[model samples]
Structure formats: structure tokens, C-alpha cells
Target: MQPIVHPVVGYLCYAGYVRASDGEAPQGELTVVAVFAAVLPDLIDQPLWLIGVTPVGRTVAHSLFGGALLVGAVGLLARRRGRTDIGVAFAIGYASHIAADIPWHVLAGDYHELGFLLWPVTGMPAYSGVKSLGTVGAVDITTLWLEAILFVAGAALWWNDGCPGVEVVRRYVG
Candidate 1:
């Protein structure tokens, strides 16, 4: 998925889960946390791979083991700080990111592309020789269509949820 899709999906997932669980939209601050967590895997892995520290863009941070460890540690710390909601939001966002990456490979039956879920246990697939970050931002037609669909769905959901987190960004920016 493109970088933008991940966070939008994360927000959609978290907001839907919150509304279903409690009949209340998520708090803006925690929604922000969820959005950040959604892209956290790529944030960790991409830089390392770009710097030649990792063999692929999906390494430790993209693995189930690594993700679990990160979420668990963060959850525990959040609990200690009396912020379990923030922890849950983070978990939802991170899990949504991993889940979002799974479908196309599963549909294509390219199970090997999913080996990164297990990291060292299953090993990551070979890198595709993509050297520059520009490749990630480039939008081909298929990706553009998918992104458009996701954006519309996410926008509707965000509006329905009272546009949670918009105030947070406005505050930071202004």
C-alpha cells in the first residue's frame, strides 16, 4: 500500500472499533497516536533498508514478533501512566497496517511476500532493487484508484466521527 493509505486505514479501523465498542468517537489526541502508529513500521524499516542496514524494507519492525514486542511494551508503559486507551489505539493502528499489507499478496497467492510477518523465523523476501524514496510516492493508475477509494471511504468515516484529530493538527500547525 502507499504511505498515505496506511494512516487513513488506521484511522478508519480505530474509529470504527471505538464507535462499535463504546458508541463514542475516539479522542483527537489518541487518534493522532493511532495515525502515527499506523506508519510506524515503515518509519522504522524504510530508513534502515535505505541505509543498507537491512536487506529489505520489511524487516524486524514489520514482523509479528517485533510488532508484538513494541505494542506490548508500549501498552505496559501506557497502563502504568494511566493511558490504556492510548495503548489500545496504538495496537489497533499497528495491527491495521500489517493487515492492510496482507490482502493483495493473499489474493495473488504469493505467500512468500508475507514471510516478513515472521521475520528471522521465516525470513523476508528479497529486495526489489528500489533505491530511492521517490518510488514510494510515485502513483501508478492502479494505486491511484485504490488510494482514491480508500480516501473517500476514510473521509466519510472521519466526517461521521465528527472529524476527530483535525483540531490536533490545527493546533500544531497554527
Candidate 2:
């Protein structure tokens, strides 16, 4: 999926959580932060790869352990600041990124198997023997179409629920 789609999925996950929470709409900041956290694991591990800390950082960032740590840290920080709700919201949002990616991974034939939920520990490349989909030549029209459908669905959900992104887009278009 493209970068934009990732955040939309994050928002969807956040919305589901909020609806389950107080049975009331979540605060705007919580939704925004959840979407932010969804992509944050990637940002943290990218620097390590650049510095030669690992062979490649993709798996590291895409690991469940990494997500757990981020959640723990966020929870701790929020507790310190007396903002526990924000911390938990971020954690769920971040994990939602993983959840969102899981289906795509399987549909793509478990291409990033090792980096799936049990990566870095199992040492098994989920798609080790399979042809890699991450390669430039591997991307094709089919993948694009699938991603486009998912994006459209996300947009519809966001718009129906009056998500922040919908309002932002409305403001700009108007």
C-alpha cells in the first residue's frame, strides 16, 4: 500500500477502538496520534539501518516486539505526564498498522513472512523460498489495483464517519 493508505487504515483501526471504548466518539487528537503511531515503528528502525546496526531494518521495524516496546514506552510516558489514555490510544493505533498489514502480506503469498507478527525471533523469512514481492520488478498492475480498492474502501469509511482527513480534504477542496 502507498503511504497515504497506511494512515487511513490506521484511522479505521483507531475508530473501531474508540467505538468500543466509551461508546462515544474519540477525541480528535487521539485519532491523529493513533495514525501517527501506526507508522512510527518504521521511522525508528530506518535510522538504525543507515548506521549499520542491522543488515536491513525493514524486519526490525515490522516486528511485534518493536510494536510492544513502542506501546510500553508510550504508556510509560503518558503515565508520567498523566495522559494514560493518549498512550493507550497510540499503542492500539500502532498495533493496528501490524493488523492492517497482515492481510496484505498473506494475500501477497506471505511475502514478508519472517517480518510478519513473529519476526526477528523466528529467523524464518515468511516468504524465504518464495519470490520476493518487494523487488521493483515484482510490483505490477494487480498489486496496484488491490491497493486502490483498499484505499477507496478506507476513504468511504472515513468520509461516512467524518474523520479528520475527510474534513481536511474538504477544507482544501473548498
Candidate 3:
């Protein structure tokens, strides 16, 4: 998925977490950070591919270890300020981003089959039966529609429940 889509999904996922945890949704800056964390893994991985790391090394960044480190590091920092919830929220959003990206990448064929899905259990690449999204041959009208809906939903969440404080944190910390 593109950066825009990743962040939008991240916002929605964070909204869900906030609503469930605090009986209120996150707004403003929190939305921004959540979106950023959601796409952070991608940011870490793609550039490395250009440098070449075999299929296995490329998959490492996308795996649980790398993600856990990201979440843990953020959590540790947030703990100093008594904002554990915020750190957890970012981690959750990041996990959600990875989860959401998998299906589409599988469908696209552009995905590296480097066993990212079976972390801790098997380090071998796992191939699925479905064709990759990139292998769809012609235009993917359905994908475009799905992306549009997700974007609108994310925007609506931000407009309705944005918190200026959260945005501030994201801008400074993220």
C-alpha cells in the first residue's frame, strides 16, 4: 500500500483502540503519529531492498522482531512521561498496518515471499495460493475503491475526534 493508505488505516485503527480503551477517540496529532508508525515499517524496509539483502534480510524488517523493537523503544520513551497508553497505541497501529498490508501484497505479487508471516516459528518464506495483487494483469478498480473508502473513513475520524496534543507529540517525537 501507499503511504497515504497506510496512515489512513493507522488512524482508523488508533481510533478503534482509543474508543475501546478510554471511551473516547483520539484526535489531531495522535492521529498523525499513529499513521506515521503504521507506515514506519515500510519506510524502514523499502530502501534497504535497493541496497540488496537477499530475500531473507529484506523480510527481517517486516518481521515481528523488528516491529517489536520499534514498539518497545517507543514504549520505553513514553514510560518516562507516564504516557504508556500512547506508546501502546503506536505499537498497535504499527501492527495493524503490517496486518493490513499483507493481503494486498500477497495479491500484488510484488511481495517478497521471505516468510514474514511465520515469525518465531519458521524463518522460511511461505507462499500462498492466491495470486499477488500486482499480478492482476489489468487495472484494479476494486483496490482503488477500497482505498477511497478507507481514506474517507480515516479523514472522518480525524475531523470528528482529533486531539491537538496527540498531533503535537507526533510532530515532535515521530
Candidate 4:
């Protein structure tokens, strides 16, 4: 999925979680956290790869253990502040990124990408094994049809809750 699609998926997944847990859509700053958390993995690893710092998009960031550790560390802070809801939302968002990537990885036979999800339990594969920038861009852009539909679905979910992003921010940050 492209960068845009991750946040959409994050919003929908987080909203669904909120709806499931609270019988209503979630709102406020935590939604913002969830959205950023969803894309944090790609945002982190992609730049490093682009700069030749790493040869892979997936790293410790892509692993379940890594996600858990990140969310857990953030969670501890939130817990201390009595904001566990924020932590939980971010955790779910991070998990959603991994969930979104798995099918694509499997479809592409990028098994090395998947191994990182198991983290220390599975030693890192040396590189993504892709040789060209065009190939990477092609993969991200061309594979967006399903993501387009998912974006629409996620927008509908947010619309159902009255498109709360801006409104929630206004209320909380004003």
C-alpha cells in the first residue's frame, strides 16, 4: 500500500475497534495518534532505505515484537497519565500497518519481509532483495486499487461518525 492508504486503513481499523469496544466511533487526539502510528513503520524504514542506510523497508519496525515494544513503551507513559485509551488506539493502529502489509508481502513472495514480523525469534534477512527504485515505486503505486476501495470504506466509516478528524482536533486543541 502507498503512504496515503496506511492512514485510511488506520482510521477505519481504529474506528472499528472503538465501535466494537465502546459501541461508538472514537474521536479526539487519540485518533490522531492512531493515524500516525499506522504509518510510523513505513515512514521510519523507507527513508533509511532510500538513503542507503538500510536495504530493506521492513526492519525491527515491521515485527510484531517491535510493534508491541513500541506500543508498550508508549503505553506505559499513557498509563501513568491515565490515558491508556490513547495507547491502545496507537497499538491497534501500529498493528493495522502490519496486517495491511502481510497480504502484499505474501502475494509478492517477499518472504524476507515477513520474517521480520517475528523479530528476534527470526533473525533478520539481509535485505529486501529488490534491486531498483522504479521497482519499489511501481510496487507502491500500482498496488493501490484495493487500497483505493479501502480508503473509500474508511472514509465512509469516518463520515458515519460525522468526519471527526478536524472537529475533534478543534475541540481538544482549541
Give all candidate RMSDs, comma-separated: 5.4, 5.7, 5.0, 5.2
* lDDT leader: 1
Better of 2 and 3 by lDDT: 3
> Per-residue lDDT of 104-123 in model 3, one digit per residue for the tens?
65556645553575554555
Off by over 4 Å in 1: 127-144
Candidate 1 lDDT: 0.84
| Colliding residue pairs in candidate 2 | 113-126, 114-126
- Model 4 CA lDDT for position 53: 76
Top-down TM-score ranking = 1, 4, 2, 3
- Which regions of candidate 3 are displaced past 4 Å? 53-58, 105-114, 119-141, 162-174
List, residue by residue over 5-64, the lDDT tens digit for candidate 2.
677777777778888977865556677788788777667765876898755655566678
Report lDDT (Cα) of residue 167, candidate 2. 50
lDDT of 4 by residue, 1-174 (tens): 667889889998899888888898888777888988999998887887688876566776787887888889999999999999888888988988989877766666667657778866876666443222234544743345566789888888878877767766777679
- Deviation in Å, model 1, residue 102 alpha carbon: 0.5
Sort by lDDT, best first.
1, 4, 3, 2
Residue 157, model 3, lDDT? 71
> Can you tell me which runs of candidate 4 are displaced by over 4 Å?
107-112, 119-143, 168-174
TM-score attained by model 4:
0.78
